[model samples]
Target: MNTSPSPSGAHHVEEGASVRLGALVPLTRPGWVEAGRHLLAGLDLAVTEVNDAGGIGGRPLELVVRDTAADPERAAAAVDDLAGLGVAAVVGEYHSVVARSAAARADALGVPYLCSSAVLDALTEQPTEWVARLAPAQSHGWRIYADFLLGAGRHRIAVVTQPSVYWASGTRILRDHLAARGGTVVELDANELTPEALCDALVDHGATALLLLVGQPEPAVPIVRAVRSDRRLAELLVGAPAGQPEFAEWAAVLGADGAGIPFLRYLPEHLGPLGERVGKELRARLGEAPSFVAFEGWDAVTVLADVLRSHGTDRAAIAGAWPDVAVEGTRGTIRFSRTPGIGVRQWAWPPVQVVDRDPTDADRFRILRTG
Candidate 1:
């Protein structure tokens, strides 16, 4: 294996005679580094497995790793750096903002990018033949949440949304989906009100369920605490679609207060055979259970390897072969769909589940529903 550092501070790891692939992740970002580490672990495992299996056309696959630091400009620059490195395809990113910028850059360079975990609805909106996602769009996941709420007979829903494009699009979809099911929605901005005031408003509106669309954990944690503390709102169903990614940390912060709060997740420990194997491998490696982001990283590499094996390492060939590519991934059978309004070249059936925060054990949240 040959390893070198580039001017952009990205590391290139080449093993044997190989087809180089690019991995863009936030390895050193303050808030995102741990997630990036787990993501890299899963990607590395997939690459190792592929190489052990004779790789694509007898050439081992190499990974050129880049740290985006969750910054948009840095992420875009990493794509350019990867293009200069002559990588066959690019995978692995967590933040949606960074993925959006990187997607544009990858498209311009004509390199196939299989997005691992970024869920912004607009990432696939731009006309790009070079980019596809392994994760579902945010709207797709929110729809699952909506179905969960409606099925549970929680009709009077209050939405607490952050001022982000990703949250806005998801909120819009949630609102429409709820309304279609004959449910009422009252929207509130998380940034505009204090947590206390937000709790008061939900109670005043008689909202049976609070749908939090905040994309980050900082605000969602406070809101959850405030809602849980209030006697009047104690019975309200608190749901945060974005909080799934940070559930372990924030749930620990909330302790017993976080119990019964529902959130959407792509993978849980109780998933079937494939999920069990992946989770066990990750646990043995990381000394803890893996997050969905890790599963996404593994699947991203898995899909990319499948594409390269059949289509060769040509960028245009990989791009052309993406639509027909189907692989049984860690989450489910991965397939791309160009459904209008959802985004083009996006995963069609991203499996999502609603899991409640366990009061006693942070790692043992029970799955309520799967969709």
Candidate 2:
């Protein structure tokens, strides 16, 4: 048995008569490469464990990976290609728009897709039995975030946003939820303003909290720096609901400025035995503390492997097994069902929390709130 890199830069293992699961991740630029790396680490670790435990009933379980690169069209095409390759199922995608495209394609092609991390409420325009998701919908998680803000007395919220379907949806969720609760949400367009100008807008709007809804490292890092340095905004709270500050990259770049900026994460207050063991392996594989996204990857495979054992590798059978998934996962007992307004089978939710890096120790996360 040998593992090698494909010409398209995808990683895969091939042995005779293997059971293949196509993996979609953003391994390149314009995508959240750090998140993708952690996600793939968890997926790979689970596959290794599954193989060690008798190779999915003696047929090797292999991951045929394709880089989505955060492109919806590219993800759709990759789904088609993976289907043609006769994969048992397709799994993993960190970007919601890309996952949406992939879900639609997988539905059309009659393939099973277990979405790992994207959390848009509407994964497909129409309901289909082919797709199931592990992430909490935007409405569920963001409302919890809004509540955290409100509880903290940050009633005036501002979101610095870019033009993207995912960001727009998140902003809408925050806006509607906050509005109903007597909180006001102000929107700042990241396209038209420099980091300094954004700071000025934050001051002008009198927003008690500023949430970064834009991409990272470019405008986000600079914006955080500007906000931290500005004397006028010294009392303002900085937030990133999209989980930008979850990775080590945030602290590596911003140092002390990255701390105390709360973000959303899906994790229980305490890991059970399964979670503890997986967390250790994932940490070794990733060379850092694994994020919740990594756990999602591990759980996706754990559920899929259980399905394959009970339902066999048939696409229709695997898709049919969504409602029957009751496997023990790192987070909790994994299951799926029709959530109101969400188009695909959803996990109801993973544990949702508002957490921030400790100001005194950037490496430690303090749980601010849970929902």
Candidate 3:
């Protein structure tokens, strides 16, 4: 029996007999550690419930977690390590850069990968049969935001995008969708200037709204504060297509400045019966409501467990079963799309909401739009 120590720093008692699953998460990174904690909570809950139900094929399921630390190289190495350890499948990742790196490794190793929350369009663009994504691609989310902006009469929009491959790709989609709808877009690189300068540019261009494509909270928090503090851009509607899962945590730092700032979130306040039960369990464990990332992690494990139960623990069997695996998750029906133009093996229907930060309560953000 293999006696290697798991990433959680514990030895698996049923080492060789158990079905091992790799969980890649950012555990120690400054911006992503909190998200990782929440996601891990959901994964733990799912694993417990699955094990309680007699596991898959009467074999216990074990999670071998590896910290990505939000770094691409570290993520790639983690995938290689998981593959070397003979994990049946791998899941749980948040950063798009890390997901891209880990996906490449999973494809190279022929290990089935279920991406949890990474949203870059290019991550699923390639024809990799072993890789499938749970979250909707950035292109899909951007289109929804574009439609909302146009419908809300925000014809003149300014976009501030961070210098990341994920944000850059989303910006292209956002630009195309806005142009197709006859909306004017002024694009600015968030890395090119300070947040104060970016706000000045928005004011000069007479922008009706500002769309932020930064995927993390560190940069987003400061930008929102800068825009809200500036009198010239005080009325400008600022929104982010990413980082909604960390809205409450980041909003706590921004205080009043974060109020009314809109963001795209996947988890709504009202979950269905099953989801409500999961939420209560998570709250009891984590002392707060489960975030969207947490739900994504839980759903990833749930889908993987279902595949394992139906198709044994073989990698090829799991990959083959993914195309037909249809399960109801927290966000609604979970199914992958092979449809052209969006992305291959990507989730098409992820319930997303444009929520505004509540002025009084940082924990309870108000939903502005849902789709």
Top model number, lDDT:
2
Flag regions of model 2 displaced more than 4 Å.
1-16
| Prediction 3 global C-alpha lDDT | 0.79
lDDT of 1 at 185: 87
Residue 277 of model 2, lDDT score: 98
The ten-residue window of minimal lDDT in model 2 covers 1-10
266-304 per-residue lDDT for model 3 (tens digits) = 775578988888888887878877788888888999999
Task: Return the number of clashes found in candidate 3.
Answer: 0
Residues forming the 10-long window of minimal summed lDDT in candidate 1: 1-10
What C-alpha lDDT, on a 0 to 100 scale, does residue 64 get in candidate 2?
94
Worst 10 residues of 3 by lDDT: 1-10
| Stretches of model 3 off by over 4 angstroms after superposition | 1-16, 215-217
Q: Write the per-residue lDDT of candidate 2 for residues 190-298, one digit (tens) a residue.
A: 9999988998888898889999999987679999999999999999999999999999999999999999999999999999999999999999999999999899999
Q: Which scores greater on TM-score, model 1 or model 3?
A: 3
Instruction: Write down the lDDT of every candidate, Cα atoms only.
Output: 0.79, 0.90, 0.79
Per-model TM-score versus the true fold:
0.88, 0.95, 0.91
Per the 3 Å backbone cut-off, how many clashing residue pairs does candidate 2 have? 0
Predicted candidate 3: what Cα RMSD to the true structure? 5.0
